[model samples]
Target chain A: MSLILARIDDRLIHGQVTVGWSRILQPDQIVLCNDTIAADPWQSKIYKSAVPPDIDVSILNKESAAVFLNNLPLECKTILLVENPEDMFDLVRRGVKIDEVNAGGMHHSNSKYEMFEYVYVNRTDIAYLRRILNSGIPVNAQSVPGVKIHTIDKLALDAIESIMP
Target chain B: MINGLVVTHGELGVELVSVVEMIMGPVSGLTGRSNSGKSVSELADEIKELISSDNDCDTILFIDDFGGSCANAAQLAGAAGSSTRILTGVNLAMLLDFVTWRETMPIDELPRRLVEKGRQAITSMGPVQEG
Candidate 1:
């Protein structure tokens, strides 16, 4: 119930999340919705150890996260972190209220459509984001708070070809 | 005057603050040191004094490591004193954001803002490089 901020940063957990995000978000719970990290004890331990002792970090997969998020206390500020658009789409399809997603850093990839210099989007990803935005969730292209904002769906997608080879 | 304290091991705490000062002007009344010599309980007691003295409704003590001595001290002090937030594993981006944002927003928003800033700072640029 306390899903304050949900981010889709490929980097599930790192210095930014443990040190930077933890400091800023001040969330009592840091929920990472990545299946791989959840199964691997070594990886989970490493991520948990990285976080400060004060905050609780849980690594859950997309399925379990749905159940967990339902039971989470309303008072606790929970941050849901995902790796890519696929995972986010999966969650969205499952009825997760992900309003206003900040495309932090998707990085450069040879995808079907080139949205921008750094972001290359495919048809499915583009459609998904367009739907999410049309639903009234403000999807902005802001890496940091200080950086310039780039409207995701509003970007000129006419020039972006659907060819991926 | 808002007071900030950085607590860490060896020179990590001081080094962090020095980096902050270099970029974002001078932060006055900021104190930091290694919490090695004293016991955990003793160190916590000392940190309490630091926070209480400068803790006039607004004070943040940045701890270098969460599981480390400095963070433990700040957490303990939080119970004794009022309005003292402890941020562990202090980093340049986080310190800058906290110090910069706290000036405008209310203290209540400090934690949320910190988390947002922290999320953006993380990067999966590549596999970790070993020197």
Candidate 2:
């Protein structure tokens, strides 16, 4: 199955993902893989409510997602939604092919370093993305499609290290 | 061309204006005034001056809270003779509605339309209860 897109957005299934990115990607199903959401049925149900009527939504954890992605047919068009860079790398290490990564939205925690507007990253967070980028998989930071896509290159990653631990 | 003015206790007016602009593009004929250090009378006078100055279009005042200082001031500021009216609980959705329908909709019906917009925007997104 063709993995149409893999997006790392904390707000897994919101307007930006539902309306904004879905308009561009138009995948058959949106598989939101998050540890917390997978465990909490209430959270999963809430997230699923945001999905469009025509499309499918799957809320799975990292292991289940890897298994599902591995088993899909070559023609299956699915969009993988990961909450953080760590989970993204988990899928990558599990032999999932990710052509590109889109960083949609990451609000600030107490210790987060604000990389861009509405995007925050910690030391470990940026490190994970940097690892993926070093492997030649480019991470493009764009909250919504049709907006200016900022390539998460060496310069952008280096800037975050200065402000945060 | 109805001129819209937002008056709030603090930065809600400014924040709401920013949200409206962020969703829509750069807009004109709309302004936001925050009551940081001004008293109720001073705020009322400030809004009154703005309402008086712009006689070209019907000015609509959108305040933060109902039955509060901001709302009372806005009500006092808007002229009774002219077509100046005040709308309370001015959220982004309401402002967007006003921005979209300001040209076509008359000043008399704009409040009801905007109030409906604000009401419709708030949804209990959880599972619906079957009757």
Model 2 DockQ vs. reference: 0.07
Off by over 4 Å in 2: A1-6, A14-31, A49-57, A62-80, A90-100, A107-114, A142-150, A158-165, B1-4, B18-30, B36-60, B67-69, B72-85, B92-113, B120-131
TM-score, model 1 to reference: 0.53
Best by TM-score: 2
What are the lDDT scores of the predictions, listed in order?
A: 0.68, 0.82
Tell me the docking grade of candidate 1: incorrect
Q: What is the lDDT of candidate 2?
A: 0.82
DockQ of each: 0.04, 0.07
On lDDT, the leading prediction is 2
Judging by DockQ against the true structure, name the best candidate. 2
Tens digits of per-residue lDDT, candidate 1, A31-145, equal 8888888887767776776666787888888898877876777798887788776777667767777666766556665555555543567766677766666666776664433
* Cα deviation of B64, candidate 2, in Å: 2.0
Model 2, residue A53: what's the lDDT? 84
Clashing pairs in 2: A1-A73, A1-A74
